[model samples]
Each structure stands twice: as structure tokens, then as C-alpha cells.
Target: MTAHQNGTISAEVSDFLLNCFVRSPSWQLWLSLPLSLLLLLAMGANTTLLITIRLEASLHEPMYYLLSIISLLDLVVCLTVIPKVLAIFWFDLKSISFFACFLQMYIMNCFLSMESGTFMIMAYDRYVAICHPLRYPSIITDQFVAKAVIFILARNGLLTVPIPILSSQLHYCRGNVIENCICANMSVSRISCNDITINRLYQFACGWTLLGSDLILIFFSYTFILRAVLRLKAQGAVAKALSTCGSHFILILFFSTILLVFVLTLVAKKKVSPDVPVLLNVLHHVVPAALNPIVYGVRTQEIKQGIQRLLKKGW
Candidate 1:
């Protein structure tokens, strides 16, 4: 990444190189073992949850439906990130075609936003069920879930389209070496010789706006839910009331905490190894995907029984 005195060699990049770990090849290969384990767990847990949800007639309710969507999104996110990461870590493949880089960038942006939106809606679901238990059935009907699915799709799909589109317009003549494991938007844009003000501003706006609004609404939803729980008559009544969303709240807590840690690690990068952020970024995708289904399984009675029944039936 040394500068040429002439400053004219940056626009020639036809393919981009990823700065996936540059340690010893053997070191990277050894690191892949744990990463591979995480990918397998994510795929297995989510797929099992999805299948069980589909097979269990009793789980046809809206709550399990939304949970199934979560499992599906987690599976998609895990696949979108991990296989290429494994290729880079294990096989030392770093070069990504220009088109492929932009495509991956688009998926990363759009899907992550959609998943965040999904979490927000899930919080609203809990809020309604807790605050207005009598109307839960009518309010969270199949049609309502369908509308939510459409909103999640339309919101992120529209906002994130510009990210990769604008990125693809950049002139990457300087170099292709992305200083990160994945085809992150900034990682690729920073290599371009062209002015990246538009790209940077758009991404910053898109990410913060989408995630910010979702987090805010989710916060208020849970706040009301907590208020409702505290007003119950007896201690047993309070616990019973909380059980309606106890599982969702627990998973959401874990999800948000890990995500916050990842953001913190980025801001404090000077205190850690140069490689630390990249490692955290890579783990951020897979670890959550792997953890979601497992946590849900433990906390949810119906899903637990569903999983047990599946095992007994040897499916």
C-alpha cells in the first residue's frame, strides 16, 4: 500500500484482494478448525430449528413462525459470511472478482439490516402479547406476520441497494487489497482512487439510521413490557407474565450485548492487535447465528419438546 509519487496507479484494479489474515499459512489453517466448528453449529442448529418448526403442527402459531424466520435469517447470514471466510483462512484464497466483491457487499448490507429489523418487530410482538394479552391472537395474526415480512424486506432492501451500487461505481485503480476478512463496504471503497465521500456518507447514514431506529423502538417496546410485568399482583403472577417473552428477551439481550462488544472492539482497535477487529468481525456473524437457536431451544418449552420429538422420531 505504499504511495507512488505520481499518484496515478489506483484505477487499474479489476479484482480486489482481501486482507484476510496474513499470518503463517499453517497458522491460518489451524485457525480454521474452530471457525469450521462454528459454521457447522450455526447451520445445524438453525436448520434443525427450521425443520422442527415446519413439522410441528402445534408450532403453527405466529410466535414460532417469527422464531422460524429468525432461524432462517441466521442460517442465511452464516452461509453468506462463513464459507468464503473458510476459503480464505484455509486455502489462502484472497482475490475476489470485481463483481463478486460488490455482490457480497450488497448481501452483507441488506441482510444485516433486515435481520435487525426482524429483531425490532419481534420486540414489538412481545410488547403486544405482554401489554395486551387478550388481543395478542387477533393482532399477531398470519396476515400481520406477512405485513411484517414485507416491511422487513422493503425497508432494508431499498435502503441498502445504493450501498453496493455506489460502491461499484468507484475507481479501484490504486489496489485491490481489502484490509479485512470480508468484502466490507468501507474495506473495498477505501482502495478506490475516486473520491469516496458519497459512498462513506451513504453507508454511514444507512447503517446508523436503520439500526438506530430499530434499537430505539425495540427499547421502548421492552420498556412498556417491563412496566406491565412489574404491575402484576403476586410474585408468581409476575414470573408467569414474564415467561411470555422471557426467551425472546434473553436472546435479544445476548444478541445486542455481543453486537455492542463488536462495535466497541472496532472503536478501541489501537489497544488491540491489528488482527483483532477482523477476527471479531468474522466471529460476530457466526457466533450469533450458532447461539440463537441453541438459546431459544433451552428457553422455549414448545421448541424444546419439538426438538425432543424430532430426535425420538429419528428425523
Candidate 2:
């Protein structure tokens, strides 16, 4: 029962079979344990960070608000893709309905973009706090955080909506087997029978436009922050500024390095093993989610103290 019948596209695909790691079935068992732990760690850590920020009066500032936004995005990304991945690994349930697959695609795209945008915004927060101490309170406020939230939501939501919609419009006469754990845009689009030039171009353009711009801005933000820190004559001031930004710097490096490697390998896909990008793509979801709060909790003294207070109260 092919969707293409009599040399014409006739029927619609009801579901997609996710061919996740089909090249090595035995690896599923080996991968399942760590993946499960990572998922649990991500869910628990992000939840705890969000709850701590909400309860701690001292953490109600603009910077912590932005951190909470990032945690929320990570939580959404984990929930959107990881459970189904674990299902495929543990239970061999690899089928996804058409609508469900597209919904997953949309969430992954939207939330990932939001996460990147939030990082850029957080860099700006650091930039202002370091570069212009007198203006930090006036410039970065609760209202600013609210407006940034709106901007991230609207920018990513509007742009990402078209991706899934355009992908769904393509005729899937070839087959409905997406060869990845999650319904990535290219994975789903590559299976379409129709000409997908528009889809490919739009995805490439939209993705780089969002991510590239954010990375460039973050770079400049840190550049200015570095200059300001170097200018400070006080030794204690220099150390404090760098310490404040070290956690963010580490998180950003991890986030962007993995993303850049994945994109490069995917673009030059002929040069690399097919599983490399797929493996990186899957890891990108959980690794960052699991590490983000841990990085913050360990590096940011205020966050560590807040968590300690939370634990003490709980006990």
C-alpha cells in the first residue's frame, strides 16, 4: 500500500516509523541506561532550578529570571524528544502518528530557538551589569524580562510554525520512515515525494539566521564585557566580573560547540558516518538539559546558597 499509486500521489501517510539506530540493535540496551539517567537528571534539575528561583525572594532579580527562562526551555526540549527516544530504546515503540511527529518537530524547533535567544539576552544582561554598573538596575528590570520573554516567544513561534507546516504540506509518497529519533525538519522533509527546494532553503535560511545572529551578538556582548573587566584597576573587581560570567561562558561554549559540530557534519554528511549527526542530535537535547542547571548551581554562589536553603527548608 504505497502512497504513490499508478504513477500519481494518491494517499496520505497515517504514521511514520522512526528508524532510530536501526544500524545497531544491540546498542540500544547499552545506550538505554545512561540515556535514562540523563533524562531523569535533566527533568529533576530543571524542575528544581525553576522551583528554587520561584521560592527564593533574593533570586527574583532580572538575571535569575533569565536563567529560569533557559531552564524552562531546556525542560521543554527534554520532554518533547527524550521520552519517545527512550521508548524506542527500551520498548521498541518506534511508530509516531503524522500529527504527533510534526508537533514534536515544531516544539523542538521553537524551544531550541527560544533557548538560543535567551542565551543572547542573558549575555546582554551580563554586558550591562559589567560594563555599566550604575545603569544595571534601571536597564535590566522585571519589565525588561517580560518584554524579552515576549520577543523570544513571538520571534521563534512565528518563524518555526512555518517549518512544520511546510513540511506537512509536502507529499510523502516516498515513505513515512523518518531515519532519526526525533522528527527533525530535514529528516521528515527528505522523505517527501514533491520538490523540496523551498523547504530546504527556508529551513537553512531560518535556522542560520536565528542561531548565527544570536552567536554573533553574544560574542560582541562578551567582547565588551571583557574590555570592561580588563579596564578595572581593582583586582577584586576583575575577579568578581569574570567569576560571574564563567558559568554562562561554559554553558554557551558547550551549547554552541556541539551545535556547530553537528551542523558541519550534517552539511558535509558524505564525509562522516550517518550515525554521527544522529547521535550528536540526540545527545544535544539531553546533555545540555542535564548540564545547564548543574553548571549554574555549581558556579553561581547565589544559586548554590539558594539551593542549600531550599534543601534545609525541605528537611
Model 1, 242-284: lDDT tens digits are 8877777776776677778777877897887667667777787
Count residue pairs with overlapping backbones in model 1.
Answer: 6
Model 1 C-alpha lDDT versus the unseen true structure: 0.83
Q: Give RMSD to native, each candidate.
A: 2.7, 1.6
Which number leads on TM-score? 2
- State the lDDT at 9 in candidate 1: 64
Candidate 2 lDDT tens digits, 172-226:
8776789898899989999888788998899988888888899999999999999
Alpha carbon lDDT at 214, candidate 1: 90
Ten-residue region with minimum lDDT total, candidate 2? 1-10
Relative to the true structure, candidate 1 reaches a TM of 0.93
- Clash count per candidate: 6, 0
After superposition, the stretches of candidate 2 with alpha carbons farther than 4 Å from their true spots are: 1-10
TM per prediction: 0.93, 0.96
